[model samples]
Target chain A: MADNEFLGNVGGRTLSKPPTPGDIFFDKSFRFLTRAFTWATIFLLAFIVYKIGGKALPAFPDLGIKFLFTSVWNSSENVYGILPQIWGTIYSSFLALILGGFFGITIAIFITQDFLPYKVEFALKNIIELLAAIPSVVYGLWGIYVLVPLIRPLANFLHEYLGWIPFFSTRLSGLGLLPAVLVLSIMILPTVAAISQDAFKAIPHKTKEAAFGMGTTRWEAILRVMLPTASGGIFGALVLGFGRALGETMALAMLVGSMSTLTLSFFAPADTIAALLANTFPEANVGLETGALMYAACVLLLITLIVNIAGAVIVTKATPGGDRR
Target chain B: MSQTGLQLPQLERQPMEPRALKSIILSAITIACAITACIPLFSVLILLIYRGGKRLTLELFYTLPPGAFDAHGVGGFGNAILGTAFMVGIAGLISIPFGILAAVYLAELDPHSKISETARFCAKTMTGLPSIIAGVFAYAVVVLVMGHYSSWAGGIALSLLMIPTVMLTAEEAIKMVPNPMREAAYGMGCTPAQSLVKVILPVAMPGIITGVVLAVARAAGETAPLLFTALFSESWLSPNNPTASLAVLIYNWSSSPYENLIELAWAASLILVVLVFVLNIISRSMGGKTKL
Candidate 1:
């Protein structure tokens, strides 16, 4: 064969060569295109803050810091205060965090600690995840139709006998903090359980074996060793769950009764910032009221950002390699 | 001392010790807590089927929703369904390509770049963003700018909520593509673009599809983002006009004083749940099969 032909035929193909101009051009453009898209994603976050903050600027000067401390929200008179909503948001989410955190951690322990057969554990995990698949609006529907009525008797009893306590001072009135908290807890359950389960699963097998070898009972080992080992992750899960509860809108709107009042009574109507935004934004007039609602949204966004970012940081740090994905 | 010259302890069978008993009780408590966590799921499912299932007729898929004061359960949510499909489809179109390309950048082109790290962190943070804030965003950027609520605004809102989910999941899928596959492609003298388009994409298709389906499902059920962006309409949907959605329809009707409207809300809830659950199952099954 000729020298040129032999060169082309080496290794059954043409010899290696630098990328052609077209190849280089296409590759460079492809990289640029992908990079552009990535930047777009980051820009989206900034855009949200800019647009929301810009709209809320007018209200900030008008309402001042008092917007967060005053409770009355008279939209018709163009006066807006979100203190009650803020209080409800924090109070309901805190209660939900406690309820959801407890059950979620326990469920995670049960599933990860060989408490059940493999198939059952897998099925249970999926079932719990399915709770998250249900829409918030449907949860609202269920809350209104089923949960409220179901809890009414207990609420009545609490009011009837324990009415002296401020928490049960008022009637259930078909919508209140109690039902909202209950639904919110249920809503955050999947987040907490799923994250905590991963946390428990990430515990080193040797750690578990060491506990067993030390003659610790299963529960003792789990409580004394595994829980501490996964404490960071579990805490992260609770924080994330709390973040989710704080932002929950439709269900809380439907169940919390949309009343802007600060009270200790769990049976009394209450409002959350998210629910307030969802309820008011539609009917809010063109200028100041809309700005106020936007301001409330800004507040809600700030809170959730702080909470979710903290939670994400904790989760990342807790994972073994400091990278969850 | 025993015959073996070791101090052999007594081997008498003993009742359960306090620690063992405590362990058993705690284990039982864990089981109880698991069951308690599951109660809400079963309750919601059973109640949904019991109440919502009763209203699931064939007409529910093709009829317009009942009027606000309609005494009879005379209409369906067909328009809302179409509107939801339109908005979610628009959101999918907008988010999917952008998300995948971003994922490509993060996972393939510049895996360790600072920009990639920032983008990844932003995406993680965005996943927890309040859906309602996305509505406010759309309201400001799309609705206020356009001077009207439009399906486009709703789509924009949903797309915001969906992009993070898609990007994160797609990045994960791309990362799961083994290193040797890329090496093989490179060894074949293929350019980076060619390799990604022809080899990496095909391998990651299943995972990408699963992510897209999951994102779409989530977008479909979101009510807060659509509440103001779409701003429910009684008429049929158009891109420029405020459009109805099943979620908003349920929200509006669930509280209606009219019994029939309430029933229609239940039916809508049922349909939404089924749609979300079906998509979830599809993604789960596809995900199971795509395990590398």
Candidate 2:
């Protein structure tokens, strides 16, 4: 009460308050709560690992090691192979990365340039951010109705011109790996663009001007200094986009055609691990079906874990003040 | 000049300098890419609206799903709207306090400990956790244990997905609070807990709320995690019943064999997008106001 009274009165002179039993309990409990919250994350991570592993163990005895390489997915036979889905996930993710990385960087580089007016910059940034906010399912719905139909003619055109190329040789079905890749790219563009924009923006103005002062043109300055300086952050952005593409579910499920086999042509239908889980989960009878499904999910878990860890490390390292941290 | 040299120089003259061409090309690429990048954005919005707009009705929002044979996009998806709200709301209730407390622990109590670093890394990695895996975890823990799929399981999965995002952003918000505020609170003979609640937390409230809102947006948009955990129901989803969600409705209807249901799917997609976009805008503007 004295301390409370002292705090109420300004210029009360430096006064130390005696800790009361109630105050001590309150402080200890507060500490306990925060500590518990902190540990909850670590515990959650372990619990996820344990839950997936526990469920997946039932399938391990049935499928053995062949589960990774086998592509045939007959649930009745107690055979579940995720190889095709694995390949599809990796292939589409990288393809999306290339698309997202290219267009996303282009957008980032575009906005970072000094010549662009503020109005244009603001609008461009807004679009990219809005693109990020659009739900994956929304993107999926759009891809199903609009993008796939548009891709059909383009697929025919490519087949007519580049039929000999394995990547473009598959029959011209509108819904396939290519549509999924395209959608994935569009989905991740905002991620790459935003990160790179922030990284480029974080650059010191003098560093950029110094390049210009040395008789370099705008292109030369950007290429020589700005890009090189922000390369770490840019790579982090790319990886971030790749990780997103890998884990993307609803959109790719709708667009990727759900073909179960691995094929070289980009025009073929395919299933990512996520798509497979989403599409088959409802119909997956019981016992081995569910267990193997969880197993596939476990694989996705490991992959995302590594990717996200790497992204986190990269991002932390690339932060402007990471050296101090 | 000698006649031969003068003639050759005049004949070989180029229209623009190489440096000029390089700058022009670079500028063109940047502007061109920015403009072209917009194609997908415009296309997605226009197509979704064109496809989804005609199907929306007040009945779609107010009533429960008609039986499968009953026609139109109206009435059926009302359950989904409420279910998503229920699950995400419950998730927000569970996660926000825990996330903020963890963030405060990192930012104020122990900024540089190894445990804190490890916790930070775990939270970062959790951001990239595949939503499907979260579903499986919830299915195993809640759905299986409860003997059926329920909204509670769905909320738990969403909470798991949301905590990392909420925690990381909350950490950033807490750290952003000026040190002087904390010192002043302490100087007033306040305990550490009092300082945290009375001074530091108030200063950080805007940013923390923004983070929580973003987490809610993410949980609301998610489909994969809810698939196994919540499952789907065509009827009204009371707290004890199986849940319906807009994302799952969009997924199911878009792929259905029936034409009308597909139309309904588009309408549902539109509603879902609008909801997510509104939440996104709110969280963004909230952060923007804080100048963070």
Candidate 3:
């Protein structure tokens, strides 16, 4: 133990401290340790870029822009094009976003509107957040064993009756873009709703009072005033959810039929970037196959970066009192 | 105007009828959507019980997976259950210390520095990085060097996935420690380091523990990040050996073309969900407002 020494008088009393040598040693070492861990955050991002980029570089020269535009993939031929997968990612995410965003916002309104009992609202919200905690793998299992079987008949019904429409034209396998979209929508709802709920709650109480004072009904107040006021934050939340849907892997991989193709029919099976990596990285022969998978991952990373950045921008501009401002 | 006086008085006395009708429909829509949104959660639980309950047997936990042709549906998934625990335990060990320290730097040491901001931003953004990227990165770094897939690499990948969640949550916990606690420590001539370790940390322990539990739950259910890192195996797992996890096992089994494998998948799913659901309930009850 370091010897105690008189450091100061009258913090209303005399104060003792460790000797200067021990203090210096402890402070220096502690600071260095904390600094390294803190910088680990930065180092983490750089390392990801370095590792993925290093592996992806081999494919870039060989495929270039062609990689993004072509759809065929066969490891046996060492030929790969990710166009179909890209379409699958975008198409499914957009479909999921449209569904999740609409319902998520509505759910936010339902839970936050003060009509339900406090305990019920609280419990419901917790249950919804549990959706976020459920492993994607479990979700995949549920989709395959339960959701697919239940939806197969409905899909077939859609196909048989609505064959005139392109989306419903193809025979339903129950494990195609439609099921993938539904699963993603269900998966993302909590994210969208939670953040939207936060935005809705943050609107000044006085705004609600003002709307009511103007003779606006409960629905009028929520739709006309509340929705517009929180639209920026709501949009941000939706983008976040959509980004999540795109990155969703295990469930989509298991449910999306693992096919590589671009088709307008929602009944067709499809693939996404994250699902592709999850499905292929294990078996990737250490050559071009690995490079292509890494390239696909890089593309997914780029998409998330764009979405996150754009979300930040929209939220900052739209929200009344954003943190950055 | 002929009826202006009559119309004005009626408007003042009553709500707009059409508007009221429209509001009613919209309100119903909101409520309907809320119920619709909640259907998936309850349905998943109900179906899991219905299907997995029939397949649940004591042997499922004791025996290796039965092959697809087994008519009896005989074996258990003891290996996967234990493997998940071991891998996530190692991941928690790796992430917890670094996460706490990084959080301490953010909360106490230099909260406003550029590097601190970079750390905060990266941690925030990294939370959204696809789990597959973490898997690929781990494979690139650990598997490539080790010349094979291993549980060590899987744990490392899970640790990366966990660090952001742990750091941000711990930062919140530590920041919640009252300023007066630190001031009192300093009044006793304690240094910033002393105040942090002796006063702030103890005060923040509950919230930090909550964060740790949630992070563990998060890591335990992870499947994507372990794909290329842990790979998969049916046998008992060693830290340096390929191992199967409950999540991965469920994935492989559910996807198998055989009905028996699918039954095993449901049984595993039931166990995994129950474990995760319990952990999440504990975490939420501890910190009702903790960030997701």
Candidate 4:
């Protein structure tokens, strides 16, 4: 009460005094820095759009919609098509999502259940987070040195054994769609696993207890009860993982062979939008080349926007309101 | 199996024979996964020490990378390290204040406003945007518009990447400052900025520093954004020049066909990883100090 008395006097001296016209005007003048900074951030976005738009407009009139559909990326003749890059980005990211979803969810389940010791679970979770800490370039180097050699024979074996399959037909090049996909899988697994782990841990223990009370086995209880309860969270995790995979650059750049051609075989040459952007943005001379690169970035940005929106929607739907501990 | 007189759930709820075995098996696999995660981190560290350890005298830190690769000779990554320090330093300078201020605005002043909400959304989206895209943005705006890629362009890109992290962490730290503290400051006639810089910032200083340190560490190890904006140099090193960082150097060398170059790349990677690891540990140590 004493402190409030003192504070009341101070606040009254500052704010409750009959508003002097000069004091109010002076305060308004002091807001210049804040407003300036706010506008500066706004200007950054505007400038970015203008720079990208100025270059992109030239190609828009002539290329129309045909440019995106065509696969040819011939530079000498000045024809650039983004179909392969777009397709590669989608294909590799999808592959990452599928592989990471399966393994990450399984691991999350293993950790959440009474499958591992407490210390082991703790250590495994830290390990996954550590994987997230390592820079993407380091992952690329590791992938090239270890993962490629390690997976080459496996890829080759798959090619030889399952040559009839469309995706497994090409000879192992050690650096192509397969390597890119595998690297992306590894990169995204930790993301998915982390999110899924949180989801699984959030499930109420009473639900599993009730399932067990019904004479269900541990696996049966998890499959029938826990999985259904956490499916929304799992979906959110997948979307987040998908976002990470789509935006990944250095690692994918190193693994994706980087030839701008669309092909069916996973072992064939491929290029992702991010990889192409990273590769060409520095070297692009001017005008259309630069514009095309920005177009590629716009596509990358769109993919991320879609991923975030989808994840947000799923997460919002999954969470029930007014449920608190 | 149900009639085998082995009622597992009814009896101690443990499968005596299989439970122990399954636990052991799961424990082993978990351990293996942890070990797998550590392999690359440890390998990079060991590689750096093995290669750089032999020439770890004072001169190694004092000289630049020699033109030719000499296996047994001593040369340094002094320029690359300095370049990295400058780039990260400039980025930190540009980003830290703005980031912390924005975070303050979001967490404290007019937090529910449409502007704050939009800012928060952009900050979050920026957090997840590819580092390469930031580089692309910088290239388009700072470099291409200016008609040349410069260190400023690289620094700006890195700053963009660093902002979202700082903003998120700072907001979190400031939000933890107990509302009564802010209320008290306001009661004493301190302006919002004053309250932030004095009361809230002091209380949140350790967390903000920790966030800043982690952000610097990430910026230090970033290779993708630097590749285009900060182009590499062999002998001539200038902060004004579009210069390369240790991480990008490592990337280039590791991918090259030359055997000795690959070793140098590994050496650089080793150093970079250790630097980041040390920074990470420092942040973790600071993060462990406070409880939410």
Best by lDDT: 1
Task: State how far residue B105 of model 4 sits from its true place (Å).
Answer: 0.9
Top model by TM-score, which number?
Answer: 1
lDDT score, candidate 3: 0.85
Model 3, position B196, has a per-residue lDDT of 80
Q: Is candidate 1 or candidate 3 better by lDDT?
A: 1
With a 3 Å backbone cut-off (N, CA, C), the pairs that clash in candidate 3 are B60-B76, B60-B77
Tell me the tens digit of each residue's lDDT in model 1 across A1-325. 5776677646566567888999999988998899999999889998899899999998788889999999889977878899999999999999999998888888889889998999999999999899998999999999998999999999999899999998899999899999999999988999999999889889889999999888787888999999999999999999999999999999999999999899899999999999999998899888888989988999999999999999999999997865846
Candidate structures ordered by DockQ, highest first:
1, 2, 3, 4
List, for all models, the DockQ compared with the true complex: 0.83, 0.68, 0.68, 0.34
TM-score of chain A of each: 0.94, 0.91, 0.92, 0.84
Give the CAPRI rating of model 4. Answer: acceptable
Residue B246 in candidate 1, Cα distance off native in Å: 0.7
TM-score of every model? 0.96, 0.93, 0.93, 0.86
Q: Which regions in candidate 2 have their CA more than 4 angstroms from the true location?
A: A1-17, A323-325, B1-15, B72-74
- Residue A324, model 4: lDDT of 14
Regions more than 4 Å wrong, model 1? A1-21, B1-15, B69-71
Supply the global lDDT for candidate 4. Answer: 0.74
Tell me which of candidates 3 and 4 scores higher on DockQ. Answer: 3
Which is superior by lDDT, 1 or 2?
Answer: 1
CA RMSD of all predictions: 2.4, 3.9, 4.0, 5.0
